[model samples]
Target: MITFEGASKHYPDGTVAVADLDLTVETGATTVFVGPSGSGKTTSLRMINRMVEPTGGTIRIDGEDIRRQDPAVLRRSIGYVIQQAGLFPHRTVLDNIATVPLLLGWRRAKARARAAELMELVGLEPAQARRYPHQLSGGQQQRVGVARALAADPPILLMDEPFSAVDPVVRTTLQDELLRLQQELHKTIVFVTHDIDEAVRLGDRIAVFRPGGVLAQYAAPERLLAEPADAFVESFIGYDRGVRRLSFFPARDLSPHEDTVFDDQTRAEDARDIAEGHGSPWVLVVSAERIPLGWVGTDQLSRVPAGVPLGDLDLAPYGHTFNIGTDSLRAALDAAVLSPAGRAVGVDEDGRVVGVVSQDDLGTAIWSVTE
Candidate 1:
């Protein structure tokens, strides 16, 4: 655990970078420090590795004052990743990842072997091991950077806007990759990002910092969205905080209707009658194996020959399916809004259609959970 007891940073000209921060970062969990620029989130992160010296107060890791250890030794024990990867331009990907291990006097072969293992661990191809930083794409370089940070298997990992330089698609992929790694490794992570969405998505707990280096509020993402400390924190979270909060609620409890679902082999006129009886304008068509085919509107079914199977009629795209067992309420809502039939399809682990829920039902679930 890392504890900042009134820890603060003051420049020679008296600029306050951090103001008496007294927060504890729990071990084996990701804690994000997020705020606007010049809010001292980066400075607080740097303080953990002694990269930035605090002019006042004490910072301790596992009860030992950070000042007691030599800066270099302390740094080598902590893994740090920064924006744009910060990779050595001339170094090969494998060599870059092996830097720390080699610096610590591991044999060349052993270091490279460990690097090879980490390269695969971070989703890089074995063939890319010989490539230079300049030869790799932006996403690959970030992966190499992550591999390098984990080269020595440090207990703590510090990331400062590591994904900010990448495009949105790549950024999300990297975020998912980090979450996967964290689940397996359980490292103490101190992540700094100006993006509140990234903080909410990745952080186990987030520390919101205000301008002038003051700590605004620190809490779990769900709580932060549900109840902001003040106007500053609330505005930082944005107007869609209520919607964001739905991510925490599971969709498993949502009741979906299977009455409007029909086998694709069923006659279109028969399916149309059943859907009309259920007061559903659209009906979900599924294959023999229960996999979702698409949606067939009752109007479309009525236009088709009475004896024709639903499989013979043109069906609208189903949009996407939300895993009822694993997905959150947000995902279900998204699926519903995007679906052509205006209903979200819920699927089991095998991608088999379980049932479907309308926007009204989703709204009810959201209300029940939020209330």
Candidate 2:
């Protein structure tokens, strides 16, 4: 656990970066510090490892005052991830991840072996081990950075907007990867981000900062969305707080229609007959293995050449699917909205199509939670 007792940072020019921060970051959970520019979120994070010294009061990790320890020694004990990844330009990916272990005097072979293990752990291909940081994609470099940080398996991690540099798709993927890692490692994490949505998705507890480093509100994402402590926090969370809160609600209450799913091997004439009976414009196409392919328009099936098999026809894009047993209502609703067929594809653990839920039904599920 990390505790801040009236901790503050004041620049030599009389500028305040953090002011009287009194909070407890729970062990083995993620705490995110989020706000706009000049709010001092980054500064507070740096204070944890003494990268940024506090001007007054004390900062303690597990009851030890961090200021008393040597700065370099303290920093090496904490895992830190920055926005740009900060990999050494000339180092091979494996060598980069093995840096800390090498510094700590592990044998060369052992360090490289550990590095190779981390590469797979962070979802990197083993072949990338020999490549340089420059040769990897921005997202891949970020994964290497993560692998390097976890090389020594530090119990506490400090991340400053680690995924912000990537595109939306890559950012979401990285976020998911981080969540998966956290579930296994259970590190005490202090993350800094300007994006409230990222904070909502990642934080076990969120600390909202205002200008001059004032802590506005610190609470769980659900409470932060359900009740803002002040106008500043409310404004920062934006008008979509209500919609965002829907993420906590499960989609299991949604009643999905199973008849909408059809096996790909079905006869085109039989599929056309089934489509006519359902009166829906689109039928979900699935493999014999029960995996979803895409949606086939009924009208298109009718126009197909008589001798051509149903599998020979092109399919309309299927947007995405959510696991009804695990995914949140927000994800299910998003799948519904994105689908060309006007339905969310619900899947089971094996990625097989279990059923389909309409957008109206999803909205009704949301209403059930909200009411």
Candidate 3:
């Protein structure tokens, strides 16, 4: 919903902060401007809301040029969030969040109602509304800043390193929260940051600016990670992109076998018969109550009376021992890969074996990264 055409910023001292920027941000997509300090990412974001007026070219919101509208009116339509929250220290959290709506002449009660709802929206409790910004944690203050920017239901948002001031854990939580909000609200956003990883994680499209305020590469995160536009872009993404690619790998790719499983109560003689019938050498052993007991070898049976119990043998498969519900792709792949029998068992929240994750399953999952 935002477009920059031949946009450049000069301070009248012959120093150009940005030059000849030409980019289009699609409606409702989170477009990130990522580069090092003095690379013009923040400058570009400010130019959108008329916070920094372009010296050379025009910025258009939707289709109309932003210069045509009053700066205050344009800013009111587009939410602005910055580092350190920019909250008014003397005001209560709810009062701070209601600032923008109040500026827009919203009724005091309605603006406050919206502010209270926003507090809950950002995972803050209602009690926090009455407290001052200084009383809240750093993360909480940032959320209040977000709520303040969003108080008026703006169609667009300009975020200038909004999450950068917080701790790493809180930054992650805010990023995830913003992503969830985007899934629902779909507001057009232009976010600027120096952190490339954050750009890749949160952006639908990333515009990487180089040293001279030049656009290096702009593409989706997957394409940018798999194939960068140049050596500089590649180096910027770093070698850990292979690790980051795991986010796209789903549980479907790591499919578990749904075949019948054997428990400890299963006799080795019967297991041998089942294995031979299926043309396999071993079977998954389970308890008498239908819980996983591990795998039993067909040839390892000694002697057993008709209904006599079979004692627990050595756990042959590493997959049989590991839990699965919350396991990462790497851990699940490792269990099957490191197994002597080349198979991993996937257990449910309970200890019972739900399915088997075999070498084929692991290979198939890895192959998905390419295809």
Candidate 4:
């Protein structure tokens, strides 16, 4: 655990980078520091590892004052990842990840083996181990940075905007990878980011810092979104916070209807009757193996010959499917909104269609949960 007791960082010119802040980062959990630029989020993160010395108060790790330890040794004991990877351009991926272990006096062979293990742990293939930093993609470089940090097996990890350099798709994949790693490693993580969405997604607790290094609010992601500490936090979270809150609630509670679903070989006339019987304007068509085919409109069904099968007609795209057992309500809502038939398809783990839920039903479920 990390404890900040009235810690403050003041420059020689009287600029306050961090105020007398008091915060506690729990063990084995991700605590995200987030706010606008110059809000001192980065400054606060640097204080944990003594990268930025605090001019006032004190900071402690595991109940021991950080000042009692040598700055160099203290830093070596913590895992730190920064923007754009900050890797050695001249070093191979294996050597980059082996840096910390080698510094700690591990044998070269042992360190290299540990680096190889971390490479797979962070989703990098063994084939990339010999490649230089410039040889890998931006996402791959970040993964190497993560592997390098974890190479020494530090109990605490500090990440300063690590995923900010990548595109949205890669950023999300990296975020998911981090979450997966955290579940297994259980490192006490302090992550810094300006993006509230990223904070909400990865943080077990979020600390919102205001300008002048003031700690505005520190709470769990769900509470932070539901109850902002001030106008600054509310505005920073944006107007879509309600939608964002839906991420916490599970979609498993939602009841998906299978009455409007039909087999691809089902006759158009018969499928139309089933859809209309259920008061649905569209029917979901699935293949013999129960995989989602697409959506067939009642109008289209009527136009086709009565004996024609749903597979014979050009069906509208199903848009996407949400794993009802694992996904959240927000995911279901997104699927429903994008679907051509205005319904979300819920699938099982094997990608087989389980059922479908209309937007109206999803809204009802959301309202029930939020209320």
Return the lDDT, model 3, position 31.
Answer: 97
Superpose all Cα atoms of candidate 4 onto the true structure and report the RMSD in Å to 1 decimal: 1.7
Query: Ranking by TM-score, best first?
Result: 1, 4, 2, 3
Candidate 2 residue lDDT tens string, 233-290: 9999999888889898887778888776788777777788776897777788888888
- lDDT by residue for model 1 (1-371), tens: 99999999999898999999999999999999999999999999999999999999999999999999999889989999999999999899999999999989999999999999999999999999999999999999999999999999999999999999999999999999999999999999999999999999999999999999999999999999999999999999899999889999999999999999998889988888888998999999999999999998888888877699888888898999999999999999999999998899999999999999999999999999999
Give TM-scores for every candidate, taking all chains together and pairing residue i with residue i: 0.95, 0.81, 0.81, 0.95
Q: Cα miss at 101, model 4 (Å)?
A: 2.2
Candidate 3 residue pairs in clash (backbone atoms < 3 Å): 262-285, 262-286, 263-285, 263-286, 264-286, 319-345
Q: Quote the lDDT for 113 in model 4.
A: 99
lDDT of 3 by residue, 201-279 (tens): 8999999998777899989887887778998888888887765655545444466764536666656566566666765
Off by over 4 Å in 1: 299-305
Pick out the ten consecutive residues of candidate 2 with the lowest summed lDDT. 304-313
RMSD per model, one decimal = 1.6, 4.3, 4.4, 1.7
Candidate 4, residues 1-371, lDDT tens digits: the string is 99999999999998999999999999999999999998889999999999999999999999999999998899889999999999999999999999999999999999999999999999999999999999999999999999999999999999999999999999999999999999999999999999999999999999999999999999999999889999999999999999999999999999999999899888999989888888899999999988999998998888887699889989899998999999999999999999988999999889999899999999899999888
